[model samples]
Structure formats: structure tokens, C-alpha cells
Target: MISRTLETTLNALALYAIAAVLGVAFFDQLVNGELPCPLCLLQRAGFLLLAIGPVLAVARGPRAAWYGVTILAGLAGAGFATRQILLHIAPGDAGYGAPFLGLHFYTWAFVVFVVAIAASALMLILRQPDGEATDEVQAGAASGDALGRIGILLVILMAAANVLSTTLECGFATCPDDPVTYQLLTPSGS
Candidate 1:
């Protein structure tokens, strides 16, 4: 019972964190008119992928597979963020995108991914299995609960918002190498 609860809470926390950050990014783009670069878009995709694990955890209860998803997504995002950081390592190179609270968005993304990995690892290590019958019952019951519903809703909303924004920014193809503005929105051949 305790393990299940802990896993559920951790999953909820992860989902909420991802949503909050995405919300901030959305507002920053909508209100500030700052367009995300291609790498930033990739990092956003990573965050969306990372959220899948937590959403699964909430909907299906604690499972190793869900945690595995989080770990893999986190590592991928971290790698991309690290590469971007290295690109700006030279003196006065001005990192890609705007900095938030003294750190670039990619830096924050790297930190979030690392933290997700750590949290998922801890959950995996600390999980104590209930009997199969009890687990099945709990998972089924939990799936219909309020938190699970909220998790599903958030995932849908975030995914929809991301798809819309990406479409507006990149249209039906790949984004530019260093997108400072919306490509699809611009006049043809500009």
C-alpha cells in the first residue's frame, strides 16, 4: 500500500512539474514573441516523452516499464541539452534562447531531465511489490481515480498544445537550424 502510494505521488509530481514548465514556455512564447530554436523544440519533445512515463504510472499504477520510459527520455533530453551547452561554451557566444533566472532554458531542461532520472531510479529501487492479485486490483481501481483522470487530461492537453504550437512554428516540415521566428507564419521565401 505504501509503495503504491509513493509511486503514485512521485508520478503526480513529475507530471505536474512537466506541465508547469511547459506552461511557462507557452506563455513566454505567446506573450514575449520569442520563438524556440530547433533544439528547444527537441527538448520540448523530450519533456513530453518524459511525461508519458508518469502518465502511465498514474493510469496503470506502479510498473517498471513506466519508470524505464522516464529514464530513457531524460537521458536523451540531457544529451541534447548538453550538446547545446557545449556549442555556446566559447566566450561571449550567447547561449541559444533566453535565460530564465540566470540559466538558459536548455540548462533548466538538462537539470529537469537529470532530476527525473534520479526520481525514477529512486522509485524503482524503493518499490516493494504487492502480491499479483492485490496489484491488479489496485491498478484497476487506481486507474479510474481522480488523480489518474487528471493525469490523462493533462497529458492530452499538453500534447495538443505542443502539436499546435509546433505546427505553427515549423508547419509540415522540419524547423530551421536556428529558428528565431515562426517559419510557417512568415511570408513565402522570406
Candidate 2:
């Protein structure tokens, strides 16, 4: 009973995150036309990785298949968060540069990345039996697997929403032609 509840919670969180990310991407990226920075895109990829874990568990009737994927997602999120924070703090010298500290976008991405890492950590460590999360997802004795399938299906829909948002935002975040490029080659005139 405990395991099933925990797994369900974890699954809910993962799907919820996907939906949130997708929502942000749509409103900020699709509507605004603002593109993601390199780090922003990296974070999106991290979210995708995290989404894989729950999806696998739901589709395959087992969560074990996504263990490594979850860890990788956490690492990716951590890496992107670190990079964004550093970039915000440090200035780039030449064509390769960092954002001036205090960009709203950077701050938002950092927060999301942190949340993703925490969520992934919890999901990976939570207890479950055998490779399959089967017994846990089983509905009370009478209902069988219908509820389980419905839950999994809901997660899938949420995941799709996330993917759609990321795709839209990722397409716009890359700003290649800024006039004032920052890199070691060219120090800031200001």
C-alpha cells in the first residue's frame, strides 16, 4: 500500500513537471518568440530525460527500466543549473559570453532545474518491489488495472504537452546574431 501510494505520487510529480515546463515554453517561447539560451535548452533536455522514467514505468509495467535515465536527467539538470548560474555571475570575453547576472529567464531556469533535480532524486530512491511496479499500481482488490492504465495514460498526455512546449521554445532560444558577442577574444567595451 505504501509503495503504491509513493509511486503514484512520484508519477504525478513527474507528469506535473512536464506540464509546467510545457506551459512555460508555450507562453514564453511560442507566444513571445523569445528563444532559449544554450543552457535553457539543456534544461529542457533534462526535463525530457526525467519524463522518460515515469513513461517507461507506465508503459512497460516496470520502473526499473528508467533508473539510469532518471539519474542522467538529474545530472543534466544539475549541470545546466550550474552553468546558468555561472553565466549569470560571470561575463564572457569574446563571441562566447555569459548573460549579465539578473536576467529573469536565467533565474527561472535555475529554479526549475533545482526542482527537477530534487524530484528525480526522490523518485529514484523511493522503494518498490521487483523490477515491475505492478503490484503497487494494482487498484484495491476489485478494480483491477483500469485505474492504473488511466493514471499512466494521464502521465503520457502530460508528457506530450511538455514535449510540445519544449520543441516550440527550443526552436526560438538560440540567438546567433547578437551584435555584441561576448568572448575572451573581445573584452567588454563597457
Candidate 3:
């Protein structure tokens, strides 16, 4: 029972951390008016993907399969970020969008993905199997704690915001390689 509670708490914290990263990305997009490139969107998707495992763990108890999902998402996200970083590797290239804290969003994404992967791996290593499953331990996860619930809600909200923003920016067409304005919002004659 204790271990289960600990796991749930940890999952809640992970969810909050992931949500914060998503929140920062969203804030930058809105406040700076810098549209996300395709790769940037992919990285955001990766972050959402990474959150799934923890969300499941909080809602349905920790499972190895869920952690595996997180690890895979982290790997995919890191690869996307790496591709973007490589694109701007040339000495004189100005880099994509703008730098946040002296590093591009992709760079920060890469770092976050690495840290998430490591943390998931550590959680997997530390998780303890229930010796004799009590009803409380078995069913407790269904009633996730308040913190976990809040974290889950925040992530969901972020996902919805991303979808709305992306639709506005790209419309139904492929997003431009270097988007200067919201395609759907712009005058058709412009």
C-alpha cells in the first residue's frame, strides 16, 4: 500500500513536470508570436506521448508496459529534437524561430526528453511489486489523488490548446516550412 502511494505521488509529480514543459512551449508560441515548425510540433506531440505512461500509472497503478511507452516516446521525441538541431548546425545559420535562454526550443526539448527518459528508467528500477495485493492496493489507483487529478487535467488542457493553435496556424493545408502568419487568419487575397 505504501509503495503504491509512493508510486502514485511520483507519477503525479512527473505529470506536473511534463505539463510545465508543455505550458512553457505554449506560452512561447502565444506570447512571442513564433509559430511552431513541423518538427517543433512533433516534439510537442512527443512530450504529450511521454505523459501517457504517468497518466496511466496514476489512474491505473504503475505497470512496466506504461513505462516502456514513456521510454519509447522519449526516444522518438529526442530524435525529432536532434533532427531539428542538426538542421541549424551550420556556423552562420540563424537557427529556427528564436532562442529561448540562449538555446532553441528544439535544444530544450532534447534536454527534457533525455531527462524524462532517465527518470522513467529510474522509476522502473525502483518500483516494487506488491507482495500481497490488498483491495486497497489493487483498487486505490482508480481514485487518483487530488494532485494527480489536477496534473492530468492540466495536460489535457495543454493538448487541447495545442490542437486549436495548430489548426489556426496551418489551416487544413500543410504548414509552411517557415510560417510567417496564421494561414487561416490571413486574408485570402494577401
Candidate 4:
């Protein structure tokens, strides 16, 4: 039987984990000069979507509906990552972007999404019966603790960065299938 406070704390931790993944992806993009492919963008979007439930759970007391959102988003993200993996599975084909820790980002994304789904399911199964929130949970939710607030802010910042980067990379045009440069940053004649 998980207390509301514990549940909220877990949700905040999940947000932190998601933000870490996004942070690494953003760092790789900027530092490594690796432009994300369309599939990679979709995978990132999936991760952002996965954060929605945790954000809501932290802001409001834990709810089954919120976890459901996380599960659905994780499934979508896993699918996108799988698609990218399969695309490069052919013999002699080099995968997109550089491999990190011997596995491509897409493969890592798939792993993260799966783990999130499993964790959300376990959380749902262990949640307190009748959606009851203890006094502590209610107070925490109302006041918003520092750790949870910081986690939420981090995810929000990462999401904003992703939006700005994607807009610069693709502009108003469709993202190039194999993006090598930022569309909006490059001269039209060049």
C-alpha cells in the first residue's frame, strides 16, 4: 500500500529520469554535431509525452488515469525506436548517429520506454485502494515540495529546448530524411 506522498515522490523521480534522457540527447546533438533523424525526433516526442502523466501526478495526487497516459506514451515511443532499429538492422548498414556506450540512441530509447511502462504498471498495481490521499500527500501536492518542483521545471526546460531545436532544424519545411544541417540556419542559396 503506497502512500500518496511516496507515489508523488516516485512520479517526480520518473520525471527526473525522463529529463536526464532528454538532457543526454540534447547534449549529444549540440556537442557531437549529430542531427536527429525524423524517427529520432518522434522518439523524443514520445519521451516528452511520457512525462505528462508524471507531471500531472506530481501536481495533483496520484491517479490511475495519469499512469495510463505514461503507459500509452511509452508504447508509442518504443514503437518509434523499434522502427529506427529495424531500419538499420540490415547487414553492413551503419546506424544513424554515433553509438553511445556501444548502443545507438534509438536502442537506448526503446529500453527506457519499456522500463517506464513496466514501472508505471507496477505503480498502478501497488497504488492505494479507493484513490485515497493521506493528509501528507494532500499537503505536499498543494504546497509542492522542492524536489518535485525542480523535477517538473527540469522537464519543462528540456521540452522547451527540444521545441526550439526542432524548429531551427526543420523550419517550416518537412524535416529532411537525413538531416545534416539546420534548415533555418543555413542560407537558402547555399
The best candidate by TM-score is: 4
Instruction: Estimate, for each residue in 1-190, the C-alpha lDDT of model 1 and write its tens digit.
Output: 3557656766876777888888888888889877888888788888998898988878777777888999999999999889888889899998876789999988998998999899888877777653443455656576677766776687679879988888888988778777666767889888
Query: What clash pairs does model 2 have?
Result: 35-172, 35-173, 36-173, 93-183, 93-184, 94-182, 94-183, 94-184, 95-183
Off by over 4 Å in 4: 133-143
Ranking by TM-score: 4, 3, 1, 2
Candidate with the larger TM-score of 1 and 3: 3
Candidate 2, lDDT over the whole model: 0.55
Candidate 4 lDDT (Cα, 0 to 1): 0.90
> Per model, how many backbone clashes are there?
0, 9, 0, 0
lDDT: the better of candidates 3 and 4: 4
Write candidate 4's Cα lDDT for 1-190 as tens digits: 7777778888989989999999999999999999998999999999999999999988876778999999999999999999999999999999998999999999999999999999999998998754465555473654289888999999999999988999999999999999999999999989
Q: TM per model?
A: 0.89, 0.59, 0.92, 0.94
lDDT of 2 by residue, 42-89 (tens): 666666667777666555443544656766776777677677667556
Clash-forming residue pairs, model 3: none
Quote the lDDT for 85 in model 1.
87
Clash number for model 1? Answer: 0
By summed lDDT, the worst window of 10 consecutive residues in model 1 runs over 129-138
Worst 10 residues of 3 by lDDT: 130-139
Q: Give the TM-score of candidate 4.
A: 0.94
